[model samples]
Target chain A: MSLLAKASAAHLAQLMGPLDSPAFDWLRTPETGGVMVRGRMGGAGAPFNLGEITVTRCALTLRAGGAVGHAYVQGRDKTHAQQAALVDALMQTDAAATIRTTVLEPLQKAAKDRNDSRARKAAATKVDFFTMVRGED
Target chain B: MYVAVKGGERAIDNAHAWLAEERRGDLGVAEMSLEQIREQLSLAVNRVMAEGSLYDADLAALAIKQSRGDLIEAIFLIRAYRTTLPRFGASLPVETEEMACDRRISATFKDLPGGQILGPTFDYTHRLLDFKLAAEGQGGAAAEAPASGAPLPHVTEFLNKEGLIQQEVASDETPPDLTREPLEFPANRPLRLQSLTRGDEGFVLSMAYSTQRGYARNHAFVGELRIGRCAVEMEVPELGFAVEIGEIELTECETVNQFQGSKTEPAQFTRGYGLVFGQAERKAISMALVDRALRWEELGEDNVGSPAQDEEFVLSHADNIQATGFLEHIKLPHYVDFQSELELVRKLRAEATEAMSEAAE
Candidate 1:
């Protein structure tokens, strides 16, 4: 998993919607092995290392320039990272209520279903506990 | 068809059941009680509390019993439990001068205001095994003399009057919590001292011994070593005042070390302090010696380049729980990492053989 690349201050301001811009900007570049997302925590002017973390981030600018949605995933799933980043960027806007109902909840439900299916498949292999007894009689 | 080994969870459950059965031993034998372990194995409980950095005697005792008397495992249990508990508030610093001492002694002074009380010490006891102790219920409680009229003031205070020892100035500054925060290089005294107090006894002892064997040796004399109970207090924001939460037994060590004058500063005997949970005098003393050895840089002495002087190494490796966990975890399944390594080695060997043949041609 690649770390998110950093973004310049001017680009960050232009990218995110007005009202409550994130203190930091992460890069959402897709690499060969996996998607790399880097976190830029805290506000500008005195940004120090939060950490070089493996993440995937995506940003979507809405129509009417009212909202910018962003999402960040810890590992290298590009689509997941993009969706998460989009959610983050959108949550800052006035359209958060609609997006939450239409997107975030559904995505979470889908992930849970997929996880349950995988868990069932794994559990199928579990053998019942048994003990064998031997006698010389 | 070989279905890959996929019963890790089931195997783990079975292993746990087997372990429980093994721990219980024969059904005819009675199970060990928590009270029995607490009272009989108090030293193990003390070690757990010392390493765990928690003061609850009952919890420490329980942890010792659950961990089968493994001090390090008990410490790990306490530490894990401590993380889950919410910290309501920090308490005011306990005044060591006012400590109700059980054992107090000053190596620097022969006679001071308070006469030395060598209470419950193995210092003068012969190393030969006491047969009486092996035979249970052989000893009777000794009658207590009324507690000495306040500890005869610390010996270091007298040296402070002579201007020979540096007078320590107290500050209202708050120190960072090491457990909550990631450690950085060049830590302050509070953080360093905190790490030393909960550090592994064997590791601290080795580091302290190294300093004496000419590794960053800053000749130190034990100014005083005292073991006693001190009350813990907390300031209640709603109540608008401090409240006494509880009391804990502690061993405190203060070392007076030779501090040759630096270019700008005058020569005076500097201090190295150690404070730990319970009556662990040896650990406290070792910690004090190591603390002094690590202070060479701050005191403007030459960098002797000793392992004890290496702050990053000492602080990082001092904790046995972290060290042992990481060390023992290698026994767990690492097939993926090993497979990758195997592939890389094969590739390298093949490349090397090809190069050797070409070179011969």
Candidate 2:
């Protein structure tokens, strides 16, 4: 669910390509609002409101007797929220394994790749003291 | 003292129309898309997000475009828009320890667990203008190496373990929101930190600079500075536990300030913190310094009587939108006030003229 929220809407939509969405009822229609972001003092102390970040959330019930799906995603993309909610509802049904293999697994891999690439880029800038060695070398 | 002086409707409309056309500017040169502004003018967007107290880059970019690149105006737009939206809830205190750091460095230490990653910095670059950027697609992929996934702990933590730095006990007490309540005197650390993080960049920078020049001097060392994305988690009514709703880029700065001690307690390295939206290291560092300066009383230091030390002064004036509103208000019609001043000066001048004639006689 966290990974789903973190995934870019475009990328998620791309990953969900050709998966036919079942008919569902909007339990709670997609709505955009602000969430006050809080941070701890010294990164480990008491909390303080930093600022607000925009979030779009939605809840839907699958008409085919599956569980209710709820999604809270970043930004104001209603379609993204709707898609996420559909995926959540679908995960509760017998289709859980299929959705996991089709959507979640690929997203997890993509996320891992992104994290690896970022870490790799940072590793490049590490100072190898041996490179700057003088007389001893 | 206040009266509506209306009757410039036509002229005002014309001015606005002209301003709109000016914002568009020479249509043939191709209009700047929001995407281009978001990517190219990112610093401007970051500044707006920081000061405006909002974290939507697309909206910030749009505000920049709408304001014709007037950052303060863009901030004002965001703030105004912010008030109209419903606040869903407050997020759990983000654990920056888990940040996927883009750049992390410790100036106090030569090297640490996380080696100094100078990710996309301009620190060593010459100030010469590169004409190539004036054209398109000058940027290329950055160099990369095999991942060395080492834990990057906060530099201050090591000092804490050795009792070399002051240990801050974590608290769960909810801090006051200035946006909801009016700022009161003798503000606490949480409130002060909140105000500083969102304070105007230029104003906070100047305050920080003053401290360096010996006004409420608090010798600050960059204990650790990290910029990266972190997940924002919130517990939903539907979901039993908190789940990540979003990831936001933040610049966190922890500064080791001048050691402080009371008669009862021993002197140890005090700390100041800054966590701001996006990769705004300059703003974050400035915020940290001012934050330390404001902590004089709490840290058992004497009253320095500096502008930065005055919580009321700094927090009240740190918001550029509020400051600019009051500052720019004078440009509007002051007709009645001016008329009274005009009459008083005229009468005084006439009286002086008569006295001069009498003296001459």
Give the TM-scores of the predictions, in the order they appear. Answer: 0.70, 0.95
TM-score of chain B of each: 0.94, 0.95
DockQ per candidate, 2 decimals:
0.01, 0.82
Q: Against the true chain A, what TM-score does chain A of candidate 2 give?
A: 0.91
Give every prediction's interface RMSD: 23.4, 1.0
Q: Residues B209-264, candidate 2, lDDT per residue (tens digit)? A: 99989999989999999998899999887888899999999999999976758754
Give candidate 2 misplaced runs (Cα > 4 Å): A131-137, B135-137, B350-361
TM-score of chain B of 2: 0.95
DockQ of 1: 0.01
lDDT of 1 by residue, B24-88 (tens): 77899888887777677777777887788776566788887677667888889988876754444
